[model samples]
Target: MCEKCETGVEILTRNGEGRRNFLRGGAAVAAAPLAAAGFSGSRAAAQPSDALAQSEVQAWAARDTDGTFAPYTITRREARPKDVVIDIMYSSICHSDIHTYKGDWGMPNFPLVPGHEMVGRVVGVGSEVTKFREGDIAGVGTMVDSCGECVNCLADREQNCLNGTTFTYDSPDQVSGGVTYGGYSKRIVVTEDFVLRIPPGVDLAGFAPLLCAGITTFSPINHWDLKPGQRYGVIGMGGLGHLAVKLGAAKGAEVVVFTTSQDKLEDARSFGASEAYLWSDEEGLRSQMASFDLMLSTVPVAYPMQQFLNMLKLDKTLVNVGALFPVEGAHGMMMGFGRQSLAGSMTGGIAETQRVIDFAAHHGVAATYEMITPDQIGEACERVVNRQARYRYVIDMTAA
Candidate 1:
């Protein structure tokens, strides 16, 4: 039986009575009874504040492999008994979004809506949903759902679910019968188990990137057991690297930044990095040899793995949070010499993601970002590929 059957049936019966009474009383019928049962204002909208209908959600989509974004209208799924409908307020452009949009990662579903860093307000809930209510702030990150019965999922590591995991966009949808449309839309319907509650006091726009970049960096830190006073080196000063600096510093680590561009030094330091060094500096690289306890490489392109391996102290580890491409011919002896290790990680599970959000808020940490509108998606994506964005770019849907 559905968990909320008793309450749900009661509500549905009252709704039936409401319709009958409305038919009898004509235009004179009061909406008080329907409102009390959770369905009143706006047809099918869970909350009175929602301005969108499930079928009228506007989105920016790439209709072909050309990767040009344009306005599109897509229908959202009807809210299920255990689902929540969100009216999207903001969506951040992640590097992965650009890659997927351009087909660099692979051929994505045409007419793709690419965005995972989503922030919005709950506008509707399923009858069985008790976690969220209308008018509450909410956020959605990379993966939307997984096989709940998988061993990894039971361990709270749903990202590594033994069964296939479902991503926010370009993923097959079992319910809606098409590839899932993502946060680059007016609204989305997600299961209650996958939606995260947004805490008060976080700048909603600034907090959006945390749903992706923040969790990407934070997961590795916690997985590797980063501790206060440990020397941590963050390679690359892009989206993931910038967050690593702030989160590592917040953990009381002596954070250093390794970058290819000399100009990013100030930007790195401003993000709470203790020092920034050009990775190209031979003398500087050698001087820091075997000094770091943990180093996170966020550079999306492959570089000299041996050089980074040389920076770790005995029994230390270097974790990669960026760059899905494989490194070519990295010398294993470098790590073997010092008993060091190299590893890779994706975003954290749902619980860990929530913990990262709360932890970042507690530290007053947020990604530095520039805001753009849906019309600017093409240019915004170009800037990210060109490494021209200051830190991150967020699509302000409120301005749409």
Candidate 2:
């Protein structure tokens, strides 16, 4: 669920010192008056990018720090060498988008179009681009660029670029001129290296969230070397958790789901969980003590760490794929006593992200999403904020 879309924003805004400036810093360039950036403000018009040519495109944007989304126009850079111009077809809303848009991560680049889980058809490619071509289906995730020479990038982990990574939106784009705008627009220009090739038969809309949710869960399972026939526990049944259920089951693990909602038990079982237990069921929770070899948590808010830590076997791990908010009663003794480990993971790097896409396609796994038209942005945002959507909410750009 997108429960974090609302509550997480409140938490971060209250606790984070630099959050209010999220829009201020990026807004300076994004919301600048005409003369400051050499614009006339008459109508959306093409302008020079940091490259050869650029075009202003139609998009939905939040004009202020309040994050009320509406129709607005933004510009996208023209394709340069190693760049791919994509006509975005679908964009899935992630909780991070909510946090960023609401200035929880600090004020975002105002006039901001927030989206990172994007899938599209390529319309143009630069001279030096070899990874993708025109007419091919491609996808872009949370990041758009990173210093290729960095150690992490060299290791195929661009998400952790030592020199700092460029996010798909709200970051300075040296090559594009203004702060990066995401896929809420009709088109986006990204370097070929950062773009992903979608498999021929995958469902584009259902597959879009994999760019973020899929890779996030897959990276840790892959990193921990989850072997076949091992016991795996998935906590939470939201977007990330649902995918984790499928991926863990696909890996041949005896997957279990730990959720507070009894209604989701059927969904969890259908997603391949061998068993589902309610978190509030003390008897059910107690029966699983020191049982799982590994546990992956996708809960979007701050949760009791010790209870989850207790689920791990000796030397086992409980990996968190959700919010990094402060935990109220986290004590090292939980892990220290059992030799268990607690860790956190972010979205995966490029290679691992692609692996997730291909693997998911092979396993016939994808997000169960609610499709919304452009005009429904406000309602969609509210639905996600209230956790009322089925699982994920995807913007259908082609809808009228």
Candidate 3:
């Protein structure tokens, strides 16, 4: 019998209309009334909301391989209350991870583990967790913790919590009493608030980067709710830009891709872009000026924005998605003639994050990812920062 809210299903003691509630009280209670009778646990999902944690596990960690990455083994902590322990099936390598791991963003913690786009199942859940249970599929993204009582948290904008939001890795973990590690490992333990519930039927492997790459692109588009027939330009076609392309198209808007690479024109169109605007082409440049409702620049290098600002019409915005040097345009008034604005955004609140996931699942929008093993982490990171990778790279932890 399936319980209300699809909480779980119980094995019936009989068949068809003859069937009454069979195995009671748990999601994993197994077998048809005509056959065997025993609990099969659950599909690494569908676990009852009140099951115990499993024991023993494995993982791949960051190790030095001649200034590159090599494999090292690691352990997972047991689950506790409000905790959802995920056995990582896949993880994605992000540009931020590459920057932080190489110490290019500053002197990073040595052997600083990297990976926030993680997908897996709940091998365990803390005693008080009602949101998830053993075997339920789950994910953790760029953020992990926040001050629950802050204005942002109370308002469902935990990404901008009054206190600095705690990153999944490289940030403090109050429960662990130490710096947090990331999804590159075999398992991850996160609070119920930070963990995401995935819609069923998608491939779990390719879904990892959707946690970060998908959301990073997803947040800004959703925040504005730019409408149908509205013009939106996605500036770049790398990991993040590519996602923006699909998301913008799903919004029922005309999505234009702005790229320095002419070779990506076909790719841009293939990835849901209605049009491709080459930055160097005078015609494209002229058409972009004062034309778009929103322009999201995902290029990693600093670019002169005077031209970009000229492209926004009245009440329009040119938002920065990529964190490049020079920070913001030096001349704010340059954006004012058309009443245009310049802004920047990070990921999003847990509520917004959930909404994006649901939206993607509904629209069948997914990130394009090249899957690799842990040994490929270094090369993947290098390519990401060097702007060599076409879109995104997801680590297949199962292969590791």
Candidate 4:
């Protein structure tokens, strides 16, 4: 359900620190912009990137403390025996990108190329790599690497490995001798181990967010063991909730949603919610308490703890997929009564991410996205921060 689009409330977005900029439309073109840097954007990201053959590759980079992103040229590493170079097509905008760009999460590495939900084709792969080669469609999500030999890595959960995971962007990668840059660039060089094959025929523009938003929502549902005929609830109607609705509905579970706007009622229904309730309708919500088997929250802001706790049935769980914020106090006895547990999840692991891809392929699930160009990235982030986007926003890297 595209609530923001339906209500004529195009999510409000402030400009690049007061500079007014509207999003560029259509698919990611990876077309080089006329920036001084002579960049060709995501086009240069294909595997075994042949930058030497191309005149330029365009990319968005945060070169200054002023906070506006500018176009620049990216030089791709030559393909090595284990290397797979991808030319980014589209990059999904996630809340974490907002935090990183705004310098809210921590001090960002300047010239920070902000993006991670990347989709592109394999333009080049080293001879040693059999999984991918020129023209293999793929995606790179939240993780890029782990130390590979830890107990957790051996268990196929690199994200939980004792050796801290190597994140796709904005984290340590001593091997690179620099903080890892992300998919906002026209191209990226990764080991074949980190690349994922994207299912064919899906809308590449809409499919961008599935790398992050899709996996984020699907993990908890699968982990929680949501089965056919089960009752589940999704809180909030933004990016995560919308996908949760479709996935839950596709899973044969009856999905109920709690939204802030009565305007979203019908839209939520389209996402497969058997029922929808406005959060402001306290009386109605209170009347039907403790009934959901799983209450999955996608809201990033704080909410009254006790009110939502009442919605869970015995042994039910409320899974938080959003970031940590200040939550209010509630009585331990209330949760103790039902043995209801509140848990949160980060991004999915590599293997689980693969499962998410297969699930989306089998179920025909994808994200509802607004495609923007590199020039519009700063604006897009501002829109997402201000809650003004229609579900999700993906940077059309091809337009860089």
TM-score winner = 1
Error of model 1, residue 223, in angstroms: 0.6
Error of 2 at 35 (Å): 45
lDDT by residue (284-303, candidate 1, tens digit) is 88888999989998887677
> What value of lDDT does candidate 4 attain over all alpha carbons?
0.71
Q: Estimate each model's TM-score.
A: 0.87, 0.85, 0.83, 0.84
In model 1, residue pairs whose N, Cα or C atoms come closer than 3 Å (at least 3 residues apart or on different chains), thus clashing, are none
**Root-mean-square deviation (CA) per prediction:** 10.8, 12.0, 8.8, 11.1
Tens digits of per-residue lDDT, candidate 2, 1-400, equal 2332111111222224222122123322232222212312212322223222577778898777565888888877767887878778889888787778878767777888888998876667777766655556778999999888867877677889999889998988878567988878888899877887777656788988999989998888887777777899998888789889988887778999998777888999998999999998899889999998899988877877788788889999889888667654567876799998888899987766766776787778889898988787767777766767668888887563
lDDT per residue as tens, model 3, 189-280: 78776887776666565567778777777777766657767899898888889888888887777898988887889989998888997888
The local distance difference test score of each candidate is 0.78, 0.77, 0.70, 0.71
Deviation from native of the Cα of residue 349 in model 4, angstroms: 0.9
Off by more than 4 A, model 3 = 1-67, 328-330
- Residue 206, candidate 2: alpha-carbon lDDT: 93
lDDT of candidate 4 over 251-326, digit per residue (tens)? 7788998888667789889878888999888787886598888878888766766677778888888888875675
Best-to-worst TM-score order = 1, 2, 4, 3
Candidates, ranked, lDDT: 1, 2, 4, 3
Query: lDDT of candidate 2?
Result: 0.77
Winner by lDDT between candidate 4 and candidate 1:
1
